[model samples]
Target: MHSRAVFMLLAAFALGACRGPKSDCEGSYESWTGSMAAHDWDSAYELLTPEFKKKVGSPKRMAAYMEDSWKGSKSFEFSPFDIAETNAGVCTARGEMRYTVKIRGELPKDHEQVYFSYVFRQEKDGLWYIELPGNERIQSF
Candidate 1:
């Protein structure tokens, strides 16, 4: 009876800790965007895949390239993602997001809507990292 109770306790802990891939990815993506909205480039950069950072160059360069994109972005939010998962466990989540940016010399309370695709890859440790995003080099502005 004691062993069964211990097993139940362990199972409960495990289940509680596992938020599932979609939830985890959503949290990570939201956190990344939150950092970008706050203009914490390095913090946002850290959430990207290693390969993306390599392709985009250092964090400073990436920030420089994206500065304009974020500079006028007063606020932003994305809709629910349509997540696609492969048998190998790779997932790509895409959604349309609205941005409030400075268009031209004026800062608008609302701007155009854009699309962002979050490419997710599971590492050996079974943790997923966002491999790419439409806001990044993968898609056009």
Candidate 2:
């Protein structure tokens, strides 16, 4: 009876461990975007893959680039319209986002709307990380 109980417990744990992200892809994408929208660059950078970090040089450089691009932004909004995952541990999220940038020395704000698609890959650690293109920005953007 003791051996049976131990086997059952191990089986349960194995099953739970095998359960991976499917619908949760959107959730992961939201967490990353939320960090960026809040200007929490460090938190946002943590969601990227190691390859992306190496390509960007370092976390500080990545943050600086984001700051420069979003310099005059007053508000940002993002909504994921579609999220898909493959059995190979690759996922893609497509969304529409807008940023309201306050023009320097001007009263008016510039609203830029962009459609973006991001690729995420699940690594050996069972955590999903953002996979960015060589140019950084999404192709549709």
Candidate 3:
């Protein structure tokens, strides 16, 4: 009976810890998406890993890429359609985004919508960050 009670207690703790971390991760991703949707480049870039920031070289270059890919936009939003996580701190997220943008006029138009999937890994700081495949092969400058 004592052993069974101990097992139950350990199981409860494990479950609780798992639940808490998952929720926090979800919240973090949500915040990340929100910042990106608003084109808050600084805020979104702040959430990126040091390696990612370094790879992009500077905020100016990063902004240029982001703007080119997402320019003249009125609004952008992401809805997480799926998420998968493994015990090794590797995670994958799939989502769809809607963006409203203007090509050259004052009135914005919904021109691009895409479904994206991202792979992330937890850093030493225990924060999840995006890691792209073949990122090393791509030179920033």
TM-score of each: 0.64, 0.70, 0.66
Among the numbered candidates, top lDDT falls to 2
Root-mean-square deviation per candidate = 10.6, 11.5, 13.2
**If ranked by TM-score, best first, what sequence of candidates would result?**
2, 3, 1
Q: Model 2 RMSD to the real structure?
A: 11.5
- lDDT by residue (53-114, candidate 2, tens digit) is 78778779888988897777767788778888854667788888888777768785656568
**Per-residue CA lDDT of candidate 3, range 64-131, in tens?**
77778667776777778877774466666778888887777476677555787766556687877655
Model 1 spans > 4 angstroms off: 1-23, 103-109, 134-141
| Candidate 3, residue 66: how far the Cα is off, in Å | 1.2
Report the lDDT of model 1 for residue 88: 59
**TM-score between candidate 2 and the true structure:** 0.70
Q: Which is better, 2 or 3, measured by TM-score?
A: 2
Q: Per-residue alpha-carbon lDDT of model 1 for 70-111, expressed as tens digits?
A: 777867776756766643546666787787867687647675
